[model samples]
Target: MRLFDYELSGNCYKVRFLLHALALPYERRAMNFHPGREHKAAWFIEHHHPRGQLPVLEDDGVSIPDAQAILVHLASRYDPAGQWYPDDPAIRARIAPWLAVADDLTGSAGAARLHDAFGYPLDIAACRRAARAVLRRLDDHLAEGASGGARWLAGTPVPTIADIACFPYVALAPEGGIALDAFPALRQWVGRFRRQPGFIGMAGIMAPQIGP
Candidate 1:
C-alpha cells in the first residue's frame, strides 16, 4: 500500500495516526500542497481522485480519497488487535454520531482556520464562531459523563478510530486561535490519548499553547 499525504493537514494526520497505532508498515509518499502540487497534474486526479485532494490511500490498485473513509478502511483491514474498531453493530451505531461530530468540528472547522492562517483569506469570524460552537457541544458532552465512565466514545475499553478521528485538530486548535481551556474533560481525554502506545503527534503544524 502507498499513502500519498501532506504532513501538515489534519485530515492526512488522521490516517497517519491510525496507521501508526496499528503498527502497519506502508510506503508514505509525501506531497506538497503549498505550490498547488496536488492540483497541477492529471495524474493525481485521474488515478487517485477527481477532486484532487491530498491523503489518498492506495491498496491493491484501489484508491480511497476521503480521510474518514481511509480510517474506516484501515481499521477494518489492518487492525488485528481489534482495538481501533469494534465488530459490534450496536457499538458502531453509538460511535457513528461522535465520528460525525469529529468530522464537522475537527475536520471542517480545523481546515477553515488553517486556510485562513495560511493567508487564504477566508471568513475568519464565521469559522471562529462555528468552531467555538462545536467545541462547546463536545465540552458539554464530556462534562455530563463521568471521567473514564466509558473507555472511549463507543463505550469500549480502549481507544478507537473515533478518538483518532478527533485528536489532531483539538490538540492543534490554538494555531488557529481557538482556545480549549474551558473544556476540562476534553483536555484530560487528549492527555490520555497521548499516553497510548504508538501514538504520534501531528508533526510540522504550527500549534501554540493555550491556557487552561
Candidate 2:
C-alpha cells in the first residue's frame, strides 16, 4: 500500500489518521503540493488524479483518488471488524450525508486553510462565512445528540468514517481564521476525537499530550 500525501493537507491527514488507527503500513510518497504543485504535474494528473488532488491511495494495483472515497475503500476492504463503515443499512444511511458534508468542509474550511497557510488565492471572507455556516449546523446536531449521550457524528457508540471524514477541517478551522469558540459542542467533539486511541496529528493539529 502507498499514499501520495502532502504533509500539511487536512484531506491527506484524514487518510493518515485512519491508516494509523488500523495499524496499516504503507509507503509515503510525499509531494510538494504548495510551492511545487507536484500533484498538478503531468505524470501525476495522467495516472493518479486528474484534478491533481492529494491523498491518493494505491493498493494492490488500484489507485483511489478523493479522500472520502479512499476512506470508504480502505475501511470496506481492510477493516475486518467492520467498525469504520458498519454493515447496518440504517447506520450506512446515516453516515452518507456526513460524508457529503465532509466535502463541503474541504471546500470551505480546507480552502480557507490553503488560502492562508499555503498562499492559495481564494476569497477568505467568503470561505470563513461558509465554514461557519457548516460549523453552526454541525454544532447544533452534536448538541442535540449530546442530550441523549451520543457523541460521535453518526451517533454510534464508536467513531466511524463519518467522524473521521469531518474531523480534520473542523479541528483546523482556526487556522483558516474561523474560530471554534462559539460552538461548544463542536469544540468538545474535536477534543474527544483528539483523545481517541491511535489518533494522529498533522501540521496544525497536534497529537494529544501524554502527561502533565
Candidate 3:
C-alpha cells in the first residue's frame, strides 16, 4: 500500500493515524503541498486524476482519494474487529453525520488554517466564524455524548473513524485563530483521542505519550 502524504495536512494526518492504529505497514510518498506545490505537477495530475489532493491511498490497483473516504476504506479493510467502521445501522447513523462535520471543519477551521499557514486565498473572517459555529455545535454534541456514556463521536465503546475524521482539524483549530477555551467537553474528547492506543501525531498535534 502507498499513501500520497503531505505533512501539514489534517486530512492526510487522519489517514496516517488510522494506518498506524491498525498496525498496517505501508509506503508513504510525501508530496510538497506548501511552497513546493508538487501535487499540481503534471505527473501527479496525470496518474492521480479527478482529484489531485493529498492523502491519496493506493492498495493493490485501487486508488482512494478524499480523507474521509480513505478512512472508511482503511477501517473496512484492515480492521478485523469491525470496530472502526462498525456494522451496526444505529452506529452508522451516528457516525455518518459526524464525518460530514469533519468536512465542515475543513471548510471552516481548515480553510483558515490553509490561509494562515499555507497562504491559500480565502476570507479569513468568514472562515473563523464558520469554525466557531462548528466548534460550538461539536462541543455541545460531545457534552451530550458524555452524559450518554459515549466518549467518541459515534457513541461507540471505542474510538471509530468518526472520531478520527473529526479530530485533526479541530485539534489544529488554534492555528486557524479559532479558540477552544469554551469547549471543555470537546477539549476532553481531544485529550481522550490523544490517549487512544496506536495514536500518531503530526505537526501542531501533540505526540502520544510513550509511558505506561
lDDT agreement of model 2 with the native: 0.93
Per-candidate local distance difference test: 0.76, 0.93, 0.90
Q: How does model 3 fare in lDDT? A: 0.90
- Over 1-212, each residue of candidate 3 has an lDDT whose tens digit, in order, gives 99999988999999999999888999999998878889888888777746577778889978888999999988988899998998898988889998999999999999999998878889999999999999999999889988989888888889899999999999999999888998999999999999876567898997766777
Per-model TM-score versus the true fold: 0.89, 0.98, 0.95
Q: Which of the numbered candidates is closest to the native, going by highest TM-score?
A: 2
| Model 3 alpha-carbon miss at residue 99, Å | 1.2
RMSD of 2: 0.9
lDDT ranking from best candidate downward: 2, 3, 1
Looking at candidate 2, the ten consecutive residues that score lowest on lDDT are 196-205
lDDT of 2 by residue, 46-85 (tens): 9999898888999997889999999999899889999999
Candidate 2 has a TM-score of: 0.98
Residue pairs in collision within model 1: none
Best by lDDT: 2
Better-scoring candidate (TM-score), 1 or 3: 3
**lDDT score of model 1?**
0.76
